[model samples]
Target: MKKMLIVFLIFAFSLSAKEVPSSGEMMFDLIPIRPLGLAALAIGSGFFVLSIPIGLLSADPRQTLEQSARRLVIYPLHFTFQRPVGEFYGYMEEIEYVSD
Candidate 1:
């Protein structure tokens, strides 16, 4: 009975293993994000006003604000539109690669 149970458990585990996607499927999943990026940029631009006070409190007000704006608006849009369609390779690459 113990041997039969072990065999059954192994068989169940094997059945749960899924095959990997084909090259085409993988490629399809990596399409460029031009539209999405543009939208995020617009949304982030609207939030710039919210960062003003935080920026003012920092030692370098203008630069702090600029950095925040770049992170919130510029970088996301740039990476989304310009990056390799299927790979993480630029500024945000480390965060993305590690997360995925």
Candidate 2:
């Protein structure tokens, strides 16, 4: 138990001493943001599946499906995986361009 505690303390100190900018942000992103993003992706995918029939039935199925897919599914997927660690704004711009 004592040895384990010492190892844990060392690991914690190492994390704090790293040169990475916004380590706190990275930790926050890793611990909560990523998981929440994944959850959003899952929930959005489910919603997209449910919206499929409506999209197909719309006056313009292609447009409806494309918009819905981008909003509900692709956005979360990109935010979750493609965004750089500790950097938040770039992915939104990318997605905006893609949507346009």
Candidate 3:
């Protein structure tokens, strides 16, 4: 029974997982998610500015500031502008900035 339950759970999870976005998801992302992300970006930028002095006081000031900026500003910017339309996978993952 346990084995069957586990197998059923795995099958159900796999079937419900969406790797590709449908047209409806694309439309929803464009119409609503993007705008909300933009708003969040703006708010986060403001908070980032306010955190600068406090961040500077940290032992590892540079790392602290960079982390704050990445979380508050960069992630939102990526979600709002850089991310592909309707791709929600990046939302839950850590974003790393790769410099060329």
Judging by lDDT against the true structure, name the best candidate: 3
Clashes of each: 0, 0, 0
Give candidate 2's whole-model lDDT: 0.87
Error of 1 at 32 (Å): 8.5
lDDT of 2 by residue, 2-69 (tens): 99999999988885454454989899899999999999999999999999999999999999999898
Please, what are the lDDT tens digits per residue for candidate 1 over residues 1-100? Answer: 9999999999888855545666665465354445566777888877876888878999999789877877887677766665545454456654432211
Q: By descending TM-score, how would the candidates be arranged?
A: 3, 2, 1
Off by over 4 Å in 2: 1-20, 96-100
Worst 10 residues of 3 by lDDT: 91-100
What is the RMSD of candidate 2? 12.7
Give candidate 1's error at residue 4 in angstroms. Answer: 62
Point to the candidate with the largest TM-score: 3
Candidate 3 lDDT by residue in tens digits, 17-42:
54888899999999999999999999
TM-score of each: 0.47, 0.72, 0.73
